[model samples]
Target: MYRYDQYDHLIVRERIAQYRDQVARRLNDELTEEEFLPLRLQNGLYMQRHAYMLRIAVPYGLLSSAQMRMFAHIARKYDRGYGHFTTRQNIQFNWIELEQTPDILADLASVEMHAIQTSGNCIRNITTDEFAGVAADEIMDPRPFAEILRQWSTFHPEFIALPRKFKVAINGAVEDRAAIAIHDIGLTLTHNEAGEAGFKFMAGGGMGRTPIIGSVIRDFLPWQHLLTYTEAVMRVYNSYGRRDNKYKARIKILLKALGVEEFARLVEEEWQDLKDGPETLTREEYDRVAAYFAAPAYAALDNIDPLAAHADSKPFANWLQRNVKPHKVPGYAAVVLSLKKTGVPPGDATAEQIDFVADLADKFSFGELRVTHEQNLVLADVKQADLFEVWTLAKSKGLATPNIGLLTDIISCPGGDFCSLANAKSIPIAAAIAERFDNLDFQHDIGDIELNISGCINACGHHHVGSIGVLGVDKDGSEWYQVSIGGAQGNDSAIGKIIGPSFSGGQMPEVIDRLLQVYVRNRVEGERFVETAQRLGIAPFKEHVYATPISKGELVGEDHA
Candidate 1:
């Protein structure tokens, strides 16, 4: 895990002091709501339906035990005694008081964390794969580059007010766990013919009103020019991006207006002046950042043979099948601690659960953990010998929910329940689906289905990429969920297509049941839900979902597709 130096420490402390005064002025009526909107948003504060919400950045999803403990303390002392982790690899406190936010930020600053750049029309937190360093298929560790970007983007004067909020994601692994194709700018670390490290740049990928898969701008960029080239792209976007309409402000919309060839040419032309300037990365600087993420002291497995022998237990086997993933290190594994229990909202953790995980990280994972974009936590370097013990402790705490890629492992946003922008509630829909698919055996039989729900088309839940995507809509002041099929995330990412009519909140569970049943009846053995849907198209599922009502008064016949 990366620690803050004096420079990092100074920046956050000064920002906290500044925001503290700003909050005081607002409370005293020295600032009106309109006057204080941008000021508060700059500090990651948002006015939600019930109260203010604060989002705290978790840089590249990495956390140390100390930082985890800080989050626990924040949840216990600030807002409610829980925090919701988000798909962007950040955490949100829903019941915040405007007056208390400065103190919360100050506490966060104490632990080398801050909420700066988590909101606002600025470059947000740079994210990467959760299994960056220890993944078996990684080309390189991306956190060093992500950290470099974080340092470069935080409070960068040039991007303070962009056309809209921007995001950047990097993927170093063969698997695209970061969902790079849907970010404002996406980078994939790769090697050139000379075997030297560089990047493949993708630009204008986003998922709001218009979901787009980013286009390849540069097939290969030398490592030294990484920052300079990025600056060039930012300059191009900041120059021509639409500012009049918020809907058309994202770089993706801009890219659509200007073709990829012209956009790439513009970026290349801008890169001429900045390519080898002060921003060109040096080997020493890269090494400095990379050294921080080097492997920790892992023990030899031969020393713990006794514990490793006990992995055959039924519970341990089930957990091992779902929770544990292969590690690059010989005797270690990456353990996923699921946050998607049946009753709990996806990606939420209570204060006690936070503390418990913090302790577990210290005990089993070299005091470090990583948050996944899929709303789960990863003990990235847990020794194989400790797997059984970790499983036992986790199961007791309601954290061991052997359903990582199953239907019940849903991804959802805090919809009408917390966000003012939401058109309908998302939590109840997620809970209902989870309850309906509570059978783990059944879920495993179905296999690798992603179900994502968003309160609105803003797509905060990444609903655009789910195998079964659910979007809440405001239809005549009532909540309606429109379903989409065949959406996917990762290297082969694709936005789902609308299947048929929108369903009332009451019909969502039954609709999902019919879709799954259709899938089971038509799918070949060993095929995942997305593969089956793609193979058979959405017709079979659509037919089953929109079939004549089993009962007289059913609303399934409605046609609002």
Candidate 2:
């Protein structure tokens, strides 16, 4: 919700003009594809398998209804009828015309949005919990710090071209909804024994071919040194991170090669010179940014039990149980508009649906919504009294599936369908799984689960951290799906282990069903799928999934057959 000032306005307008010129040159054959590649990437344009894909940044996942409407307009006018929301909380249009991207960006700039730093080996969008300011468990709102980082890092000359892409996530809540452990740099807002707010800094966490959790670099970095310390970390990585191979270029690879102690030592040595310098955040600067995120005006009212009145309404009760979240404020609730309807691609919204969500945000929330890292949208400040009405409207638009955190609430990437880098189609795999578990009663019985699907090892869908992960692989020039179990995100984040050999796309649903059976059988009372998997380990699940040889007919569709 940070409004652009004169300087912000000037910077965006100038960038757009520069990109417009660059795009024109590319079209005119004045600039070769090699020359225009970096320029276009810097602007978040990609040449996909079919058409160009444009990724627009939604900083810290915050969006005003006005911005949402702009997205809807862009989807309707420039791209196809729908856009894909990504795991990073950004949105992508798959059928973009390279020539029209500048116009699209100009349209975005009108709403104080841009596509800068969305791709390339630079610091991508800084992300955090969708319920940042409204979470009951938050120690402090993390958005101000996130915004401060955003302002500082945008086009920073030193980090514009790192050895590989960098990502940072900050979490202010007791729960790690932001998945801090799997970021290049992760910060947890905390207070020192002296009651001074600071961060628990962790670095080197990432997922790809080599998945590893970040190590804590500093137990308590005082709030003032946030920027200085962050710069120091970047400086260390930039100085020594590998440039030879893209696979080993991430900071996590560097941290692994050097060890945590040495990495921390280097960062500290670098920080000594920068600490307490002008880059150190002062109270006044903090306040300036914090003002934008001050609490919204609320009506004086007591909290009410929403379920009391909807007890007889099964549909309403189901939606309330899955989609509604507790708010920090009384008389309010945060609602997730589920994008994981059975047949729809995960995290995709049609132009009309996007507009409808914008309308809902205006009517129910404070004209705002937050995009969850889980590929859902959150109306973070809905009145509890208006829950039913919100649900009714959302369900009518196929945005109220009541499957948040459940098996069908899958997080998936636009795989072979849109991304040239993908090995197999991810959307269909997600669709098959969702259809398999469409029964609400069966899903609730399975309990909270994070099921993620990625087309490749890039981990864009964050399959490495899902309770059940499905990864698409290229096997003998054929697309096969690999299943992993026991992974989880949050305070106790862990990378999943591959159960066994890859399966045909058609075998994915049956494979998942077998994994769940193992979970249900081994789980004790009150155990979730992840808890049960962790307790019994992957052996039992692996055995059951591959135990029975599937008939040849099962491999007939969407596979090498």
Candidate 3:
């Protein structure tokens, strides 16, 4: 819930005005699509398969109730009446008109939001954990640092163009909810032996043609030098990162070619000029930014009695156990609004649901909301005593699917339905899997599982992170999905191992059922799917899935059918 200062306000307003004129010029045919490509991309506009998609930056995934309401307004006014929340913790409006875009940008500016850095090959939105301010295990709130980076990168002359799209993620918590390890630059706040805060600077991570996990470039970059050090990295990348081939353009690719030692030497040389520059965090700037994200007021209440009583009385006790996260404050509970309902696409919240979330944020969580890296919205500080009341309101809004962090809490892309690059419909695949695992009691007992579906190999859905990753590809124009297993997000992030031959759309759900059956049958009594699969490898599951069951046609014994 960071507030905009006068300077911040002016820059956003000016950007909107600038983009508005540019949009007008494009419509007037003064600028061709080729000429306007970079211009529109700078403002987060993209010409996707079916329509123009506008991605609006939600810095660090935090949203004020008012700002979120503005998203609802935009969704209702332009394009379809819904927006897709993405893995990068931003929202996308597909089916946008060329002309109405500027008006939408103006409206977003009014609410202190913008489309800048949401597209193009420059520094993108700086993402952190959704529970930064309220998580029980946080070392410190990450938003102040995120905001500082925003100012440093936004419209900065030097970084206006880069070799490729750059991403940065920061994490200050024990659990790496921000997926920091897989970003272009990852910063984790940690304490040194001297008991002072600094960042564990990770470099060279990205996903695309070549996926990589970042290596530790600087073991402990002092907190005061955070911005200056970051600028050093960007400088090193801009000066030497590849521009020859788009495929080999990311900082990660450069780092891979140069080797970590040589890259670190280059960064060290660059950092010498910026150890005490203007972008370095001063006490005044730190205090000013930190003031905006000071923790919310909470009334002390006993959670033990009320939560125990509710747990005993409620049918959603299983849900309460899986979806609800612990809050830093004693009596507050961080509630996740699950979009992963049975027979519905995961992470696809309707426009009505957006408004409801805004309302609930205003009423229940101090007028603040957060979108999770897992593609869900969160009321970060709901009182434990009001869990039932919050659940009731959420149920009416169709946000009461109790599958957060479970197998059904799948991550997916628009697939063939919305993506031009997609060969298959991913949403339907997500729905079919969710429907297969609809039983709450079963899910609770089954434990945590991740299912990621992408329409293509572009991996927009982060299929590399899912426990069972499904990637759609075309085999002679028929939609086929390739399966991978044992992928994980968080601290030990790893890309999944591919199983075998791909399956058609109709065979997708059946394949998933077979995979789950293998997990269920082979697992130790209390073992989770991820653990069991990791322990036993994908061979067992692969064999079961490819096996022709009783439901499938078989050859006759005497004569071939």
Per-residue lDDT of model 1, residues 39-59, tens digit only: 999999999988999999999
In the range 326-379, model 3's lDDT, one tens digit per residue, is: 888888889999887775566767778898899999889999998877889999
Which of candidates 1 and 2 reaches a greater lDDT?
2
Sort order, TM-score high to low: 2, 1, 3
User: TM-score for every candidate vs. truth?
Assistant: 0.97, 0.98, 0.95
Q: Compared to the true structure, candidate 2 yields what TM-score?
A: 0.98
Best-performing candidate as measured by TM-score: 2
Candidate 1 lDDT trough over 10 residues, lowest sum: 552-561
lDDT measured at residue 294 in model 3 versus the true structure, 0 to 100: 86
The candidate, 1 or 3, that scores higher on lDDT is 1
lDDT of 2 by residue, 410-470 (tens): 9999888888899988988888888878999999999999999999999899999999998
The residue pairs found clashing in candidate 1 are: 500-561
> Cα RMSDs of all predictions?
3.3, 1.7, 4.5
Which runs of model 1 end up more than 4 angstroms from their true locations?
302-312, 550-561
**Top candidate, metric lDDT:** 2
